[model samples]
Target chain A: MELAKMEALIVDDHPGMRTAMRLTLSNLGVTHSQFAQSANEAIRRIKGQHYDIIVCDYNLGPEQDGQQLLELLRHNNLIDLSMIFIMVTAERAYEKVVSAAELGPDDYLIKPFTAEVFRVRLERVLQKKSAMAPLFPVLQAGDAAKASELCNVLAASHPAYMIDFLRIKAELLMGMGQAEAAQQVFEGIVSERAVPWAKLGLARTLRLQQKDVEAESILEGVISESPEYLAAFDTLASVKDKLGKAGEAQEVLSKAVAISPNTLARQRMMGDVAMRNGDITAAEAAYTTIVEKGRTSFFRDPNDYVNLSRALLECGKNEDAINRLREGRQSFSNAPEAVFAASVMESQAYSQMGKAAAAKEALGRAMALKDSVPMTDELKLDLATACYRSGDEAMGARLMDQVVRNRHEDARLLQRVRKIYTDLGRELEGEQLVQSSTQAVVNLNNQGVLLAKQGNLAGAVELLTEAAAQLPNNQQIVLNAAHAVLTLVNREGWNQDLMLKAKRYLEEVRGSNATHPKLVQLQTLFNDVQNKYGSRV
Target chain B: MSGQDEALLPAMLAASLHEVKNMLGELTLSLDALQQQCPQQAAQIEEMRFVTRQVSDRMVQVLLLYKNDAGVLRPNIEAIPPADLLEEMLMEARSLAGDRLVVSLEGEQAPPYAYFDRYLCEMALMNAIHNALRFAHSRIVIGVGRLGNALCFSVEDDGPGYVPAVLQRAIEPGGHSRDGGTGLGLYFADRVARLHCNNAGECGRVQLDNAGVLGGARFQLILP
Candidate 1:
């Protein structure tokens, strides 16, 4: 933790800032320092070498700001908790910039700060980092229980970081699916002081426990008190969405976007919620911003273009949708999924424009490419829509049934399915299909759970594993299989084949949604079993 | 200007000021390097750095005032150790004062952690420290203490006390002394202080007194 021993990277577009930062770092005895003129160069340097610290300017020549860079680093797992990252901003309204980020830097320094101030902030962060060093290994190993235990010890020893330790403990509990315990910790913090973060944490915990009413009230209070807190807005929108108020969620997201408009995830969420609310104009605007701003950034996704096209088609701008799909097809020329999505959307646009021949041609192209790439539920829904529009009811029904079977628990997708069916005047048939598919999955899951309860772990594992194989994208069934496998291993002896099966099941769920609540618990259980049996698998 | 252009005027000005402030920050570091390389002219370099910091601080004040006008200047209050804040101000003051003045902490120990905005309070206290460094005959004392239910940070200097006119203006609402400088620092300090309020709805304020612990001027920023 010595300043002289720390290797640092300074990221700034201005040569003057680089020179100034270098001089300042040297003044603080930080001799081993590197400089990068932009975020891309900084990322490149970070990939090549390890740096103990990174001091990056908030404005990095318009390509990517420091916050976006931090997000990229975090999302890609390029940076870990061991290193320190500090953001430097000249704007006094820096809260907007920092709060908009999903993963903020370790600390931020306001611009025009002297070397003395910089040293103080750096030293403070270093102290906190060292205090947290003991828990990192366990945390990285996915041992949430052990990490929570260490948090208590660290809070006692490092009283200055007690709240920080408690916050981590709360998040760990949430990750382990112990919503009640997380709620207690958050409540303890909020009772002493209604800190905005603590309130937000409590609201999230409440939502996890299905207490949406309480969560909604707390989030409303948080947003009113701290209007610039963008995270609160996001959480509030989610809670509202869970309460079936997509229109209200869109309004809340609009306010947050007005305050700070550059967050890609927020923009995407805006596009989604607006689309759900049938505000096609707002959806088009949000998707347009995403497609424009994300063109050259890591946040760019081919789905953004598809989404934009969908909005345009909804707005009766078929030619514009077709033009956008053509451009998107070229931009993502080598990605099969992108090509497939563009083709499907193109067919939809053509069908909407009353060009049956063109639509039929596009549909043929899409069907040929469909099997070449994995289909997301959204893309499958689009293909189904295209099929129905092109007078292929049987093909559309088959696709819809597959989607419903795989994502039976997804209310939003189910709603979209219903809309598609209603638009085609097949509401009764669609309802029956949805009910039968959902009931089938529910019966299978229930039977497995029942077998496990009857002390027939082998029977439970066999049933759930087969169900999971049949519906690979079904997170609930996959998680149940993994849980049964781990529970059997824990109760009986560890079986190598069963352990690998459990690992694969967990990995499948993680590949689709890493932050799934059941994932961390199952992963921790798997790790514990592995450690106990002393097996590499 | 068009209506749209007029609406963007504050943001444009704020951006320009931020750019200027960054340049001033660079100039300050250059002065620090120059002082190190040419120790004989360290005092002169330090003085130039002092002026550069003053401009930078003024830019921040203007930007903050604009935010206040736009009703967005909310303080991000946090629990910060009082000693750390005082120590930071002491270091900056000593660097600016160099060998000309004795800048020191007033108390043996700092108070417990207090809830306030560290950056805003630092800006206010540093402005007072800079004022003290300008007029102090020999020394400046920075300290933190409790005032009733509020936390108080004071900058006391062994300099000529504030003039009666300035002291009177300090007590007046929206008052600025037209004595020597633009009085923006005091106005900004007052605005920053008022932005901090406790759950009990008690707002913070600035108090100026001629009777100082250093037998001169004493400026106190009291926050609830």
Candidate 2:
């Protein structure tokens, strides 16, 4: 890749910037190049022929941006790996930059650059692309194995791109749950660089091996080095809570929330921790903030209001609690979860206020709708607690068993289940029930994995599918079934009976992990094979 | 081209109507390089280049006003070091003066950081300097200083004084006090000053007043 031979495309809405960039390219002896003013025009040009370079202004026209255009193009596979993309932005935004980097652009250039600065950027990108040219054709043709091998070679030869290539390679490795191999690369990178992403990768690998303590340390290292990395703080805090270091976890979350006060999940986690610590004031604040701020965000949760009402009821604010629950329902008019949770709160409020008839009405409504409950582990826990408090101890114990079974690998959730049982006056049985349910879930998951590996794919799929019904929202159970069925279908032919079972299992897995690479990849191959062949026996 | 479209364009293209008083800048730099090679013709060529750059500056000011009226103007705001910025402006004024105007950087060099889009600030300064050069009799003095709270940067000429109507227009409710609001040099200057005020941050103000060793119009920009 001689500089002069490389074809470059410059896209900008402003004629001045476009002219400036053209002059820059000409200065580097690239006399021939293409130009486009809008995203649509750029896409049209790209479709006609591949260019070695693209210099796109971050703001195209008023309608779309460079990153959005890139996403749309890559999503459709209209552009190949060898076409180097450079996004030119004024750097006015923070989120857009991160998203572009994560989605993978060749590089970025801040606006108003001099000729020298522009040349420095172009040369850097061209050098890297040329170095990785050996693998480009295979990657372009969708050969993942050749792409991986090429990436390995580039990682060894090009020390500059080693970090980036290794991280991408490790993501593919971990997707297949080759945890030991992924950890080796992650550990190698972290040993020299102390990079936040690599450290987090190592933590994720350790999490697979159930090493919470070491994973917690890696997360903490990320926090110390880069306090603004929100994901690290979140993972570290969750690991702390899961390790029963509730107070420590709360402190970590408090710092994280101070920096970025916007996620519904984090606020809900805070509320739950506050409730555990008997900090009703803090719990109300956390829940109220989430309810108020999460109105426009995708992370909005109805649990915030339900928890708030519960906290108010515990404090003897019956009127306030009643209004709180009503407000929650009014805000989320059509959500069944909100409707059900609010009804539960209304029942508790009325029962406490000595309004027996209203209490009975609310309780009956909850019971009627409980049969059609969405069956999330969270909802199950809430219902089980409600039943136990209302004196149906047997049913409550059974429901609690289900929550415990779903979260068998989660020691801290088991503790909460134990506490909930003790609160309802089944002290002796609560301990026994939590242990029994946890063991059952672990046993079933292990047995299913063993069966799948032994080529008893039919039996493994059956076993995991039945378990998914019991623990519908559990990641491990749903994924086990999806993976088992996908493996069976991918290795052997897709039997019609097995394809239906696999589709059901995959539907559950997709909801929780759309980008979990293995599941996403398997789902694609499985669906294609299922549609094309009918080799049912 | 269509008959109607052809009818719209000027038949004999002349210089832009805004003002040929500025942009001696682009010419001077180009001519200065040429003069080094041809010293025998350098003196007269240098003079022509200086005058040409001055014309270009005025042209840009008027062109900016034209575009402002057409509503096609886009301003870019970026942070610049006020001290280095002031120093550079002084150097440009000094070069244009060629011993006639003595511009000195005063007080602290611009602080390490000040926020205003660089090109916009440069245009505003260029206008005030060109305006001062035209009005100054023999010597023009451009001063950089801080007044109380904000960075009060001024361009002053040791000329007789500002024309009365122009002075009044600087303070008047609108910038359209000239014969035809089209010359718009003062108007665009005022607007650029205003546009650079707080672009998404603090509110800054641009103003014209009389306060100088030379009893002339002073252009002041206060950025928060």
Instruction: Please list the residue runs of candidate 2 whose C-alpha ends up more than 4 Å from where it truly belongs after superposition.
Output: A1-150, A153-162, A310-320, A371-373, A388-398, A408-410, A426-465, A473-537, B1-224
The candidate that achieves the highest DockQ relative to the unseen native structure? 1
lDDT of candidate 2? 0.67
lDDT of 1 by residue, A2-32 (tens): 8889899999999988998989899989999
Please report how far candidate 2 places residue A208 from its true position, in Å. Answer: 2.8
Query: For all the candidates, what are their Cα RMSDs to the real structure?
Result: 4.2, 17.9
Model 1, residue pairs in steric clash: none
- Give the runs in model 1 whose Cα sits over 4 Å from its true position: A1-7, A23-35, A44-49, A99-103, A113-117, A353-361, A388-394, A449-455, A479-537, B1-45, B106-112, B145-150, B159-170, B173-184, B208-215
Q: For residues A84-155, write the lDDT of model 2, one tens digit per residue.
A: 888887543423233213244676655434466566556766766776788777655644544666779887
List the global CA lDDT of all models: 0.85, 0.67
